[model samples]
Target: MNPVLKLTDVTRIHGEAPHEVLALRGISFEAHPGELVAVMGPSGSGKSTLLTIAGGLDRPTAGSVTVEGTDLAGLGQHGRARMRRTSIGYVFQGFNLIPALTAAENVALPRELDGVAPRRARAEARKALEEVGIADLADRFPDDMSGGQQQRVAIARAVVGERRLILADEPTGALDTETGEGILQLLRARCDAGAAGVLVTHEARHAAWADRVVFLRDGVVVDETGADRVDVLTGPGAR
Candidate 1:
């Protein structure tokens, strides 16, 4: 089967000639259905830039990014926004939930924005919350929940619509180890159900949950290995 997300020779440059910095350089990557690929690297290595470009939140200065078969550049601004709502789900390291909105409402917000009826959107949101194992907290506001609970709401929102591609950047960064592992388990389950996933993480243990691991350095893919062999990148004295 074809990849749900593909980035081909993608390059992203910030600023202009005199002050520009390359955030990504001739990088190509893909995440196929039923797969979870983890991108790992040190600070300034372009992991987050790669994710934003793939999710259409940022455009590449060169090359192409395709999601669910549509090239992002060809989509234009509005088109890309539409695609983001219908086909892609992004989870940020910081939970970007609205404090005033309850868990269910926050999860439903995307579908509602997409023109789904309020009642139907709510039903779907609750379903997603249930899938994330937090249905009981549907009415709790972000401020009223624990960090783990709030993050669960974030995950529910991301997968609420059966989005074809899921992009997560340091999704477990804010939680305790146990809570973070729980979050990773949820992501793994989502990929097992067929939504392609790309996780950007710096922790080797977290990356181990993925099917494959990609190592980046200075905006380039320096190496890649199956999750089972991640030690190739993080083994003792391997760096």
Candidate 2:
């Protein structure tokens, strides 16, 4: 299958030479459409750095990242930003929702920013919310929902458009195990619908939901394992 996302010998460094610390070193990987891959590591393992570079939020110091076959290195800042806004969906651990906006409104923010009509954006947002099983809460504000519900809204918002790639950073970190599992199921459902996803997480249980888990240490990929035997607490079959 053709890859939807690929990272080739990618590296990111901080500070200057001598004092420079490498966040990522010669990292390479790929995710095909309908696949869910996990990035696992301890703190400071460079998982976040890789995700940011892949999403175009940060530029790599070296190597190349291509999404949907287009090399990100070739795009200027503005072009990359536009591509990110349109082709990729990002879900952060913090559930970055607008406090004042209702669920539907929050989901509509991206389309609105892209100059989509308010009515049509709301319709699309409703569909996304429905997909995540949060349609009933469409009029509720973020503060009015539980953490799980809020995260679902965030997920809905992330997938509401024509986005094909989802980059999730510790997506379920804030929720309890049960809630986190629900979130993972939602992501799986999205993948079943043809979107590819890369999740950065420290929780082995969370990583289990991925088809493959790439483990990172220091600034490099040290190991990768298939998650077929992984249960929710350790492997991919976790409820």
Candidate 3:
């Protein structure tokens, strides 16, 4: 199967030369439809950098990012925004929901921005919220909910419209263990249903939900292996 997301020799630098930091170095990566790749790394290891670049929220200083066959660099800002709304789903570490909108409205916003009718967007939002087991919280605003509920809303927003690529950064960080596992299961199911997923996580148990696990350190991939070998590679209970 073709890759839904691809990064070729990607590099990202922050700040000017004298004070700059390299967040990624010539990293090449790909995630195909029906695959969920977990990126495991310590702090400042570029796991989040790779995610932002892949989601088009940030551009690489050098090299390329392609999603569903479209070159992100070639799309320019508005084009990339369009692609993000229609084809890519991103779940940020911080719940980035608009405080004023309720869970359902926040989830529906993306589809509406993509030109879907308001009613249709609302319908899709309902389904997405239900999928995340938050249907009853549909009318609740972010500030009114618990952290776990808010995180569930974030997940619902990301998966709302049959998006082809899903990018999640520490998605379950705020949830309880059972809820976190449920969130992981939702992501696994989404990948199984033919979407490509990239999860940035540090937990081996969480990595077990992935089809493949990639280890990164100092802005470089140190190793990669199948999910079954994560405990061996990361060391049992390591992370």
Query: Which scores better on TM-score, 1 or 2?
Result: 1
Clashes in model 3: which pairs?
Answer: none
Question: Global CA lDDT of candidate 3, please?
Answer: 0.89
lDDT of 3 at 204: 90
lDDT of 2 by residue, 145-180 (tens): 999999999999888886999999999999999999
* Runs in model 3 lying further than 4 Å from the true structure: 227-239
For each candidate, the alpha-carbon lDDT, in order, equals 0.91, 0.87, 0.89
Cα lDDT of model 1 by residue, 8-76, tens digit: 888889999999999888887888899999999999999999999999999999989999899989989
Top of the candidates by lDDT: 1
Task: Please identify model 1 stretches exceeding 4 Å from their true place.
Answer: 227-239
TM-score of each: 0.94, 0.92, 0.92
Clash counts per candidate, in order, are: 0, 5, 0
| lDDT (Cα) of model 1 | 0.91
